[model samples]
Target: MEILKKSQSGSFESSDIIILIEPVEPNSGRNIDIDSSVMLEYGDTIKALITSKLDSYNISDIHLIAKDKGALELTINARLETAIKRACNIQKATMH
Candidate 1:
Protein backbone atom coordinates (compact mmCIF):
# COMPACT_ATOMS: atom_id res chain seq x y z
CA MET A 1 0.00 0.00 0.00
CA GLU A 2 1.04 3.61 -0.42
CA ILE A 3 2.23 4.18 3.12
CA LEU A 4 2.24 7.90 3.70
CA LYS A 5 3.68 7.03 7.10
CA LYS A 6 4.73 4.03 9.12
CA SER A 7 3.96 3.05 12.71
CA GLN A 8 6.16 0.86 14.83
CA SER A 9 3.47 -0.26 17.23
CA GLY A 10 0.65 -1.37 14.94
CA SER A 11 -0.80 2.09 14.86
CA PHE A 12 -2.22 2.76 11.39
CA GLU A 13 -4.05 5.67 9.92
CA SER A 14 -7.63 5.67 8.68
CA SER A 15 -6.40 4.85 5.19
CA ASP A 16 -4.55 1.77 6.34
CA ILE A 17 -5.77 -1.68 7.38
CA ILE A 18 -4.07 -4.30 9.51
CA ILE A 19 -4.22 -7.99 8.71
CA LEU A 20 -3.31 -10.70 11.17
CA ILE A 21 -2.20 -14.12 9.93
CA GLU A 22 -2.60 -16.75 12.64
CA PRO A 23 -1.51 -20.27 11.89
CA VAL A 24 -1.44 -23.11 14.37
CA GLU A 25 1.98 -24.35 15.31
CA PRO A 26 2.55 -28.03 14.77
CA ASN A 27 3.07 -30.05 17.96
CA SER A 28 3.34 -26.87 19.98
CA GLY A 29 -0.38 -26.18 20.14
CA ARG A 30 0.35 -22.49 19.79
CA ASN A 31 -0.28 -19.85 17.17
CA ILE A 32 2.33 -18.14 15.04
CA ASP A 33 2.12 -14.55 13.88
CA ILE A 34 2.67 -13.58 10.29
CA ASP A 35 2.23 -10.38 8.33
CA SER A 36 1.05 -9.78 4.80
CA SER A 37 2.02 -7.09 2.37
CA VAL A 38 0.17 -3.81 2.43
CA MET A 39 -2.34 -3.44 -0.37
CA LEU A 40 -2.50 -0.24 -2.42
CA GLU A 41 -5.61 0.55 -4.37
CA TYR A 42 -7.93 3.47 -4.80
CA GLY A 43 -10.93 1.30 -4.21
CA ASP A 44 -11.88 -0.62 -1.04
CA THR A 45 -11.89 -4.04 -2.66
CA ILE A 46 -8.73 -5.14 -0.94
CA LYS A 47 -9.89 -4.15 2.51
CA ALA A 48 -13.28 -5.65 1.88
CA LEU A 49 -11.77 -8.93 0.80
CA ILE A 50 -9.45 -9.08 3.78
CA THR A 51 -12.14 -8.12 6.25
CA SER A 52 -14.58 -10.68 4.93
CA LYS A 53 -12.00 -13.43 4.87
CA LEU A 54 -10.65 -12.61 8.31
CA ASP A 55 -14.12 -12.55 9.76
CA SER A 56 -15.08 -15.76 8.01
CA TYR A 57 -12.05 -17.53 9.43
CA ASN A 58 -12.27 -16.05 12.94
CA ILE A 59 -8.51 -15.54 13.17
CA SER A 60 -6.93 -13.30 15.79
CA ASP A 61 -3.74 -11.81 17.19
CA ILE A 62 -1.39 -12.57 14.27
CA HIS A 63 -0.25 -9.34 12.71
CA LEU A 64 0.15 -8.73 8.99
CA ILE A 65 2.28 -6.08 7.30
CA ALA A 66 2.25 -5.47 3.54
CA LYS A 67 4.46 -3.43 1.27
CA ASP A 68 3.43 -2.60 -2.26
CA LYS A 69 5.54 -3.93 -5.09
CA GLY A 70 4.06 -1.92 -7.96
CA ALA A 71 1.71 -4.74 -8.88
CA LEU A 72 -1.36 -4.29 -11.05
CA GLU A 73 -4.28 -2.87 -9.14
CA LEU A 74 -5.61 -6.34 -8.55
CA THR A 75 -2.30 -8.10 -8.38
CA ILE A 76 -1.54 -7.10 -4.80
CA ASN A 77 -5.12 -7.63 -3.81
CA ALA A 78 -5.20 -11.05 -5.40
CA ARG A 79 -1.87 -11.95 -3.89
CA LEU A 80 -2.99 -10.99 -0.41
CA GLU A 81 -6.28 -12.78 -0.90
CA THR A 82 -4.49 -15.90 -2.02
CA ALA A 83 -1.97 -15.65 0.78
CA ILE A 84 -4.61 -15.27 3.46
CA LYS A 85 -6.81 -18.03 2.15
CA ARG A 86 -3.87 -20.36 1.83
CA ALA A 87 -2.59 -19.47 5.27
CA CYS A 88 -6.01 -20.14 6.73
CA ASN A 89 -6.14 -23.54 5.06
CA ILE A 90 -9.08 -22.71 2.84
CA GLN A 91 -7.20 -23.51 -0.36
CA LYS A 92 -6.54 -27.07 -1.45
CA ALA A 93 -3.48 -28.57 0.11
CA THR A 94 -0.74 -28.98 -2.43
CA MET A 95 2.60 -30.76 -2.27
CA HIS A 96 5.39 -28.45 -3.26
Candidate 2:
Protein backbone atom coordinates (compact mmCIF):
# COMPACT_ATOMS: atom_id res chain seq x y z
CA MET A 1 0.00 0.00 0.00
CA GLU A 2 1.61 3.17 -1.20
CA ILE A 3 0.82 6.63 0.00
CA LEU A 4 -1.57 8.30 -2.44
CA LYS A 5 -1.11 11.94 -1.42
CA LYS A 6 0.18 14.34 1.16
CA SER A 7 -1.11 13.67 4.65
CA GLN A 8 -0.02 14.56 8.15
CA SER A 9 -0.63 13.70 11.78
CA GLY A 10 0.30 14.86 15.29
CA SER A 11 1.37 18.33 16.34
CA PHE A 12 4.41 20.40 17.30
CA GLU A 13 3.36 20.45 20.93
CA SER A 14 5.85 19.26 23.50
CA SER A 15 6.15 15.47 23.92
CA ASP A 16 4.60 14.92 20.53
CA ILE A 17 5.64 14.55 16.91
CA ILE A 18 4.42 15.76 13.56
CA ILE A 19 4.63 13.42 10.60
CA LEU A 20 4.08 14.29 6.96
CA ILE A 21 3.73 11.67 4.28
CA GLU A 22 3.72 11.86 0.51
CA PRO A 23 3.71 9.44 -2.34
CA VAL A 24 6.72 8.92 -4.58
CA GLU A 25 7.05 7.39 -8.03
CA PRO A 26 7.19 3.64 -8.23
CA ASN A 27 10.71 2.16 -7.70
CA SER A 28 11.92 5.50 -6.42
CA GLY A 29 12.20 3.94 -3.00
CA ARG A 30 11.40 5.32 0.44
CA ASN A 31 12.81 8.51 1.86
CA ILE A 32 12.42 9.59 5.46
CA ASP A 33 13.68 12.88 6.88
CA ILE A 34 13.68 13.12 10.66
CA ASP A 35 14.10 16.13 12.91
CA SER A 36 14.02 15.51 16.61
CA SER A 37 15.29 16.89 19.85
CA VAL A 38 16.68 13.44 20.61
CA MET A 39 18.25 12.92 17.22
CA LEU A 40 21.74 12.51 18.55
CA GLU A 41 20.60 9.71 20.79
CA TYR A 42 17.80 8.02 18.86
CA GLY A 43 18.02 8.98 15.23
CA ASP A 44 18.85 5.55 13.89
CA THR A 45 16.34 3.89 16.16
CA ILE A 46 13.54 6.16 15.04
CA LYS A 47 14.35 5.54 11.41
CA ALA A 48 14.39 1.83 12.00
CA LEU A 49 11.03 1.92 13.73
CA ILE A 50 9.53 3.88 10.88
CA THR A 51 11.05 1.56 8.31
CA SER A 52 9.76 -1.46 10.13
CA LYS A 53 6.22 -0.11 10.13
CA LEU A 54 6.40 0.73 6.45
CA ASP A 55 7.72 -2.70 5.63
CA SER A 56 4.86 -4.27 7.58
CA TYR A 57 2.49 -2.58 5.18
CA ASN A 58 4.61 -3.41 2.14
CA ILE A 59 5.01 0.25 1.33
CA SER A 60 8.18 1.29 -0.48
CA ASP A 61 7.35 4.29 -2.64
CA ILE A 62 6.94 7.20 -0.31
CA HIS A 63 8.58 10.12 1.45
CA LEU A 64 8.20 10.93 5.11
CA ILE A 65 9.01 14.15 6.95
CA ALA A 66 8.95 13.79 10.71
CA LYS A 67 9.57 16.43 13.34
CA ASP A 68 9.66 14.98 16.80
CA LYS A 69 9.15 16.85 20.04
CA GLY A 70 10.72 14.30 22.37
CA ALA A 71 8.06 11.75 21.89
CA LEU A 72 8.29 8.11 22.92
CA GLU A 73 8.47 5.09 20.66
CA LEU A 74 4.78 4.32 21.14
CA THR A 75 3.84 7.87 20.24
CA ILE A 76 5.98 7.82 17.14
CA ASN A 77 4.46 4.55 16.07
CA ALA A 78 0.96 5.88 16.53
CA ARG A 79 1.55 9.16 14.73
CA LEU A 80 3.35 7.51 11.84
CA GLU A 81 0.65 4.90 11.42
CA THR A 82 -2.03 7.53 11.52
CA ALA A 83 -0.30 9.63 8.91
CA ILE A 84 0.17 6.68 6.57
CA LYS A 85 -3.44 5.65 6.91
CA ARG A 86 -4.57 9.17 6.26
CA ALA A 87 -2.41 9.38 3.16
CA CYS A 88 -3.99 6.21 1.86
CA ASN A 89 -7.54 7.29 2.80
CA ILE A 90 -7.93 4.41 5.19
CA GLN A 91 -10.58 4.74 7.90
CA LYS A 92 -10.11 1.72 10.08
CA ALA A 93 -7.17 0.32 11.99
CA THR A 94 -6.79 -2.73 9.75
CA MET A 95 -3.13 -2.00 9.34
CA HIS A 96 -1.49 -4.41 6.89
Candidate 3:
Protein backbone atom coordinates (compact mmCIF):
# COMPACT_ATOMS: atom_id res chain seq x y z
CA MET A 1 0.00 0.00 0.00
CA GLU A 2 1.20 3.49 -0.81
CA ILE A 3 1.29 5.93 2.01
CA LEU A 4 -0.36 9.02 0.57
CA LYS A 5 0.33 11.34 3.51
CA LYS A 6 1.72 11.56 7.00
CA SER A 7 0.17 9.16 9.52
CA GLN A 8 0.91 8.52 13.16
CA SER A 9 -0.13 6.25 16.03
CA GLY A 10 0.54 5.51 19.69
CA SER A 11 1.69 7.95 22.38
CA PHE A 12 4.74 8.99 24.35
CA GLU A 13 3.60 7.39 27.55
CA SER A 14 5.83 5.04 29.45
CA SER A 15 5.93 1.55 27.97
CA ASP A 16 4.55 2.87 24.69
CA ILE A 17 5.81 3.96 21.31
CA ILE A 18 4.80 6.51 18.74
CA ILE A 19 5.09 5.72 15.06
CA LEU A 20 5.09 8.24 12.24
CA ILE A 21 4.88 7.31 8.57
CA GLU A 22 5.29 9.67 5.64
CA PRO A 23 5.15 9.17 1.93
CA VAL A 24 8.34 9.32 -0.06
CA GLU A 25 9.26 9.08 -3.71
CA PRO A 26 8.62 5.70 -5.26
CA ASN A 27 11.73 3.53 -5.69
CA SER A 28 13.52 5.44 -2.96
CA GLY A 29 13.08 2.44 -0.70
CA ARG A 30 11.97 2.38 2.93
CA ASN A 31 13.87 4.58 5.33
CA ILE A 32 13.36 4.03 9.03
CA ASP A 33 14.50 6.44 11.72
CA ILE A 34 14.32 5.26 15.28
CA ASP A 35 14.69 7.03 18.60
CA SER A 36 14.53 4.55 21.43
CA SER A 37 15.48 4.72 25.05
CA VAL A 38 17.09 1.32 24.68
CA MET A 39 18.79 1.89 21.36
CA LEU A 40 22.07 0.56 22.64
CA GLU A 41 20.56 -2.90 22.90
CA TYR A 42 17.27 -3.24 21.02
CA GLY A 43 17.59 -0.81 18.16
CA ASP A 44 18.23 -3.42 15.54
CA THR A 45 15.45 -5.62 16.80
CA ILE A 46 12.96 -2.79 16.64
CA LYS A 47 13.95 -1.89 13.11
CA ALA A 48 13.68 -5.47 12.04
CA LEU A 49 10.22 -5.81 13.47
CA ILE A 50 9.05 -2.70 11.73
CA THR A 51 10.56 -3.81 8.46
CA SER A 52 8.91 -7.19 8.72
CA LYS A 53 5.51 -5.70 9.40
CA LEU A 54 5.82 -3.23 6.51
CA ASP A 55 6.92 -5.97 4.21
CA SER A 56 3.99 -8.13 5.25
CA TYR A 57 1.73 -5.39 3.97
CA ASN A 58 3.88 -4.89 0.87
CA ILE A 59 4.79 -1.35 1.88
CA SER A 60 7.90 0.34 0.64
CA ASP A 61 9.14 3.69 -0.59
CA ILE A 62 8.22 5.53 2.57
CA HIS A 63 9.89 7.15 5.53
CA LEU A 64 9.11 5.88 9.02
CA ILE A 65 9.95 7.51 12.32
CA ALA A 66 9.53 5.53 15.52
CA LYS A 67 9.84 7.01 18.97
CA ASP A 68 10.00 4.41 21.68
CA LYS A 69 9.44 4.93 25.38
CA GLY A 70 10.78 1.65 26.69
CA ALA A 71 8.04 -0.45 25.20
CA LEU A 72 8.27 -4.20 24.69
CA GLU A 73 8.36 -5.97 21.37
CA LEU A 74 4.67 -6.79 21.42
CA THR A 75 3.68 -3.19 22.09
CA ILE A 76 5.87 -1.92 19.30
CA ASN A 77 4.42 -4.44 16.89
CA ALA A 78 0.85 -3.54 17.77
CA ARG A 79 1.41 0.18 17.41
CA LEU A 80 3.29 -0.16 14.16
CA GLU A 81 0.58 -2.38 12.75
CA THR A 82 -2.09 0.13 13.70
CA ALA A 83 -0.18 2.99 12.15
CA ILE A 84 0.41 1.08 8.93
CA LYS A 85 -3.23 0.13 8.66
CA ARG A 86 -4.19 3.74 9.19
CA ALA A 87 -1.75 4.99 6.58
CA CYS A 88 -3.06 2.46 4.10
CA ASN A 89 -6.69 3.25 4.89
CA ILE A 90 -7.33 -0.37 5.74
CA GLN A 91 -10.23 -0.91 8.07
CA LYS A 92 -9.90 -3.26 10.98
CA ALA A 93 -12.48 -5.97 11.28
CA THR A 94 -14.75 -6.01 14.28
CA MET A 95 -15.77 -9.26 15.87
CA HIS A 96 -19.35 -9.65 16.93
For every model shown, the clashing-pair count is 6, 0, 0
Q: Give one digit per residue, the lDDT tens place, for model 1 in 31-64.
A: 3233324333433554455455555555443344
Please provide, for model 2 over 1-96, each residue's C-alpha lDDT reduced to its tens digit, 9 standing for 90 to 100: 968889989999999999999888899999899999999999898899899999998898999999998999999999988998889888486543
As for lDDT, the candidate ahead, 1 or 2, is: 2
Give the worst 10-residue stretch by lDDT in candidate 1.
1-10
Give the runs in model 1 whose Cα sits over 4 Å from its true position: 1-61, 93-96
Q: Give all TM-scores, in the order shown.
A: 0.38, 0.92, 0.91
In the range 1-96, model 3's lDDT, one tens digit per residue, is 888778788899999999999889999999999999999999999989998998898997889999998899999998998888777777478321
Candidate 1, backbone clash total: 6
For candidate 3, list the clashing residue pairs, or say none: none
Residue pairs in steric clash, candidate 2?
none
TM-score of predicted structure 2: 0.92
The local distance difference test score of each candidate is 0.41, 0.90, 0.88
Candidates 1 and 2 compared: the better one by TM-score is 2
- How well does candidate 1 match the true structure in TM-score terms? 0.38
